[model samples]
Target: MSKIGFYIANLVKRVQNYSRFKNVFLQRLPQRFHGAARLLFYHTFTADEKKLATEIESFRSRIPALTTDKEIYSYTSPHSNTFQTDEAGNALPGEYVGSAAEAHMKTGSSTFNGILLRRIVAGAGVKKILELGTNTGFSGSYFLSVPGTELVTIEGSDALCAIAKQNMDRFSDKHRIMNMLFDEAITQLLAEAETFDCVFIDGQHEQKATLHYTQRVLPMLKPGALIVHDDIYWSEDMHQGWQHMVQDPQFSETVDLFYKGICVVGNGSGTKAHYDIGEYLPRPEIFRKNW
Candidate 1:
């Protein structure tokens, strides 16, 4: 079966197995769009996905600081997390062998969203950060690392928001917080009449829409600020999105590591620079020696 076909078949099987899949949203979604429904189903799950949900939730629960530690770093711990080194202990490669996990735990991202976020947060000396796509509060949580770095993160799902809220309680008193859908968030942000030094765009993986968000929010960024897009290699569309943004002839650099993409917007003339910050952990040796 095709990818979307498999998803629909599995969904039907799930609905047959459990009443949970027969919800108003699920029924209405497919009825609204027979072809596009699979996109939603692709990310969401049927009854079988409960296993992943359980695993991911369990992993979230184990973390001491759910908001920052687990959400931002891609489940790799800072102290135990190793780095790349040359044959003479200089520098060569890296990997996230420390903690490999999926979004909901079936399969996690190998890229290290955590490390880059920390480095940039500290390096930029940004006093405030606005994060898009605050999934489980992972990336947004990283804002806690910078002393007094205020955070305004947005997430779409109410369930995810509740889970993020629970996780964020650990660091609730530390940073500013805002969890809502992207559309509602744009309205809220505009109404607040506020702007930030940095904005991390990691929302829905759609290429054109993501680019639209980047463009719409450009004026909200600081003159020498930073805006990073995750999973540029996630799809051809995303790759195209990355390419389209850089084509404006306004950027100084663009970087791509297979897992993530970073774009920098700054300088007096508004040039752009993008980079793939290699491997976040650079510990391929662990898998070579162990796994």
Candidate 2:
């Protein structure tokens, strides 16, 4: 899109977000206190949040040089044109041929999302995290930034997994990298009777797969555990899957941040609610980096 078009679209989104914010928070405050409340809600950031923001900014700045332009083969989803298949047309494990620089640029989460993930982990005090996609380990590093956090990240591509292992090693040694399909890794975890404080679903952006994996992992989540669904708006089907999750009885609360969706399991609130706070949140530094 052209720069003007992008600006216009963003302006429209901001207007809609303002309306939602007003309904969700401002309207509930006393009329005279609304201005003060809004200011406090958006302007204030905890010390941890600031620290995470700085860490991600510094980390992302070094990614390009670290990855360089080295060519590599990463896993390809069946939905992609490059996915491998047998002569009989049966699907087989496939590799996506691309340079490390291209893979990171195309697959890694943005700096804004990285900071958001880290802030959530730190705020929720997440110790054990199960990440479905360990694409180059960029986002996984953020999850591990919080002290004492141990991650079990799964990636289908061996090459990508190896890179992720190296990246995650920089943060902590308390992580396990599984270079296998999502279902396979999840099965192993379930068989081991493993449970997690948080689960990040960042792979298989298809509706059926998303729902299926989420249901399969339900038994492996601890009480009040968080289930984060990335790229919720990637496609109509993905959005539908996210909607289904929001309506599911297991989650006591759901939050839609446009780019990412979050669900809390059995929060014991005796009520279920969904919040759309993507545009409502402060993001003045989202585009600070040139990349």
Candidate 3:
């Protein structure tokens, strides 16, 4: 689109975002319209999603429960990471999973990756974790909340990285968060000869960028390492990136759970596994819960 068109579109969106009744643009005229307010939204959202707005109200009617640090990691393969976790759910050092973050979804990492992360951590007993794209530091805080864990989160925006660093500091003094964006930081991170138990990519939304980040971090992955990319259905770009990651021959032993796609290195034949983890939230006690 032209710059002027883009500007006008953004203006319209902003106006709609703050408007009383809501007025959304329909790029193409619909074959049928139930009502003025019921027209299909822009390319980003479909008519079926209108139910989500109503579901939020019903969700608020019930109190949310917490998913603890231990409960988070119980989902990982019991044989993969190997830890001495108690029955109550404890992430023993050196056995953990890592996850990515996005700008708009605050505390989403906990709700999404928190349980799986702790389970993988406890299972693998992973002592170190690497994360790309630290926004608001909620995911980083969740990772740090694990028992005896060390983490390194990288972000391109210095301002955002600084905020993440502060949040990480609040949880634990041992983490190392970097301010460089992933594009530039990948080289520096690789140069350090670091090998993490878990490598997470949750930064840019573009397909090519996500692929680039994956390849850039490939050499940094140790044996049995797990890479997580968030928001598979957040956009077409994201879904395309995730599809490429799983279908391409370069990687195998993968899991595509719609909301989050995981790439595994080493072990197993070239078989691919797909699951429906459905979108989930983090344990409320360990991390802030998003309403």
Instruction: Estimate the Cα RMSD of every predicted model relative to the unseen true structure.
Output: 20.9, 6.9, 17.9
Query: Which regions of candidate 1 are displaced past 4 Å?
Result: 1-59, 62-111, 176-179, 250-252, 267-291
lDDT of each: 0.50, 0.69, 0.52
Per-residue CA lDDT of candidate 1, range 235-262, in tens? 5566667778666544444444334454
lDDT of 3 by residue, 53-156 (tens): 23322322221221112222111112221334346332222223432222223333543354444444544566788888675566676677667888888765
The alpha-carbon lDDT assigned to residue 168 of candidate 1 equals 52
| Worst lDDT 10-window in candidate 1 | 282-291
Model 3 misplacement above 4 A: 1-113, 267-272, 276-291
Compute each candidate's TM-score over C-alphas.
0.56, 0.73, 0.55
TM-score head-to-head 2 vs 3, winner? 2
Query: Cα deviation of 92 in candidate 3 (Å)?
Result: 38
Per-residue alpha-carbon lDDT of model 2 for 1-291, expressed as tens digits?
556775566566656676677676555432423322343234344576567656644544455565444765665432323334357432344345566554464567655677667766666677999998898787888888778999999887776776677777878999999988787788789999999989998876666667767887889987678898987766666777888999988898777666567788874556886665544653222221211
Residue 13 lDDT in model 2? 60
